[model samples]
Target: MARTTKPLTNTEVKQAKPKDKVYTLSDGGGLQLRVKPNGSKFWLFDYHRPYTKQRTCLSFGSFPDISLADARHNRDTSRELLAKNIDPKEYRDEENRINEAAHSNTLEHIAEKWLEVKKANVSADHATDTWRSLELHIFPSLGKVPIHKITAIKTIDIINPIAAKGNLETVKRLCQRLNEIMVYAVNTGLIASNPLAGIGKANQNPIKKHLPTLKPEQLPALLKTLAFASIKTTTRCVIEWQLHTMVRPSEAAGAQWNEIDFENNVWDIPAERMKSKKPHKVPLSDQALNLLELMKPISSHSKYIFPSNSDIKKHTNSSTANMALKRMGFENKLVAHGLRSIASTTLNEEGFDPDVIEAALAHTGKNEVRNAYNRALYLERRKPMMQWWSDHIEKAATGNMSLAGQKGLKVVSQ
Candidate 1:
């Protein structure tokens, strides 16, 4: 013989008074309103532990916070768990922990962790560029999403817009980067497996395009346009410096005064700034030296030879030469990087040793031993060849039409 409990109503719960001692008003099925002597009311569900079968109580909330309707809903949920031999308390705690982890393990957060691990293996500039690409492409949409919840379809939706813009290369890189992050998550035990393993297979591969460059004969016209172009003197000097030095735009722009060896007539670029991650010595032609002398008054106090107009502590944008080339109406005709191509073509056509030309360009071949030997063997040979290239540029600057017709095109080793 058991006494069945009556269900509590909202009116009864609201009007229930507290006694000198703690007491409960049962609503059946283990749900009760716990009225304390202090007059505070709470919803409690008494149940047996799943495995131990020990009796215990789980608090839903206070009466006003967990209203009669809300308390009944929670009790029904707890009853379902009990029928499955699951303890409601354990289940709730596990759910809370999972939610906490999801909030903390966002995609951006995990990407940052992966980058920290990445920084040790790559150059500083490469690491910075990698993070910047992620910020520009991936972070706006998927940054806040939990790492585990990121699926391939959602990722493709985000990347499809970039692909539609004909920026297939950017799409390819984004897919590769996302997959790297997913693999990192899997390795770290943050997620079960990588859903983005083959994400790059979805994108159309980007065609490899070389930088637009001018023919050797066209250097005269290009130099003439640069001389009279309506651009800053500092910008013009940067272009000329890169032209004479045969270095990459970023390497030229980031040149520091300390890197110059005035006695040796060379510019020693550190390994960190180089693409091959090796220190390189460029023999400074008289033309390159003249460009340096011109920049001394303007940037002698700053570390960088071409300091930014707004911030003297930093170098000017690497694109300054490119932008100037565009403003001079060389858009799609030539780029700053193409300046290197011009120098390479001219040097090769002039019949200098191919090894010396490659050494001058700081190019590394697949053979590590040969590259090391060339770096040591070619410095003296490269100096005179660099001088000859500068003399050719000088002739072009003065409107000398063709390389074959130019005089003093000889390399005399110093």
Candidate 2:
């Protein structure tokens, strides 16, 4: 006849004393209370390995910490798994691994991985700005939250304070960057799907504010102010360089000597330096060439044409022109970026070809075919327009009491 083992009770378990040797008190159904000579007790479940049918023991925990009821509950759970031909120990280990992964795969961790890949596609400054935005805004709230638990509601809540402060533009950018991170997670199989998609639609759209700029007729005043401004020679040259080239401030600040082709009169800006992420060939006018010639004596030894005032090894800061303008008493009246607006407005109002002007500005188009045509056929046609624009600047600078150019135009304030 088969023998039947009685289950352990809470009273009996608590009173059970350790013996001289190690032993176990069965609680029936493969459950037992193990006691050592040292008086330590542990809960064990003896069961057969699924499919293999080999017997092994699974540890639930220890006595007092794991009560009789808790041990029975664990035993029942294991028995259910055994009935389904699943090994309980294997299942527990897999659960542990998954839990560990979910804990480690935080939003900040995934964002860091995504940034490593993102840095290759964007400029260094842009990549740095992107990370800084996260550090200032998003990271404090949800950075450590696991990617799986990241919801659109949580993101909206985090950015709402920024929106409340009339910084919808920052809020908009935050949403864009967060969405990129989520999409990255989904693509890499870190998460099943993006939860923060279209979250920007939930917020009010930001009002567009154009940078403070001057009218085409007001060019003489700007040129006059810049010519007499109490700033460094390199700062003065960079402002004129940006004015003549019509490139962005950062592009002008980062100009390298190798990019200039004195023979061709073209400045070949690399794709990485451009906002459109395409290489641009700026047709250099005589005025632009003169600025380079003037800079040659000061920065001929360095790689950059516009080396920083404090650090010759590094290029000038992108904000140098703006700060110089402020010191010249044009604060809130105009900005370094407004220099492009001055060029664009003058070129467009002069009835120059819109496509040629856009090409000069390095503005891209959505139509790939037209973009290819512009890249091929626009270079020669843009030369005359560039020269015309430079001549216009020369005309404005002529009588402005500056070092170079002839004078005829009168200074007019806004």
After superposition, candidate 1 runs with Cα above 4 Å error: 1-95, 117-129, 366-370, 399-414
TM agreement with the true structure for every prediction? 0.76, 0.90
lDDT tens digits, residue span 1-414, model 2: 989998889998998899999999999999999999999899999999988999899999999999999999999999999999899999999999988898899999999999999877777668888999999999999999999999998889999899999999999889999999999999998889999998999889999988998899989888878767788889988888898899999899999999999889999999889877888999998778877778888999999999988889999998899999999988888999999999999999999999999889988889978887897799999999999998888778655644334221234222
The per-model lDDT (C-alpha) reads 0.87, 0.89
Q: Please provide, for model 1 over 262-296, each residue's C-alpha lDDT reduced to its tens digit, 9 standing for 90 to 100.
A: 99999999887888888899999887887887788
- Candidate 1: worst-modelled 10 consecutive residues by lDDT: 402-411
Candidate 2 segments whose C-alpha is farther than 4 A from its true place: 151-154, 198-202, 401-414
- In terms of lDDT, model 1 sits at 0.87
Lowest summed lDDT window (length 10), candidate 2: 405-414
Best by TM-score: 2
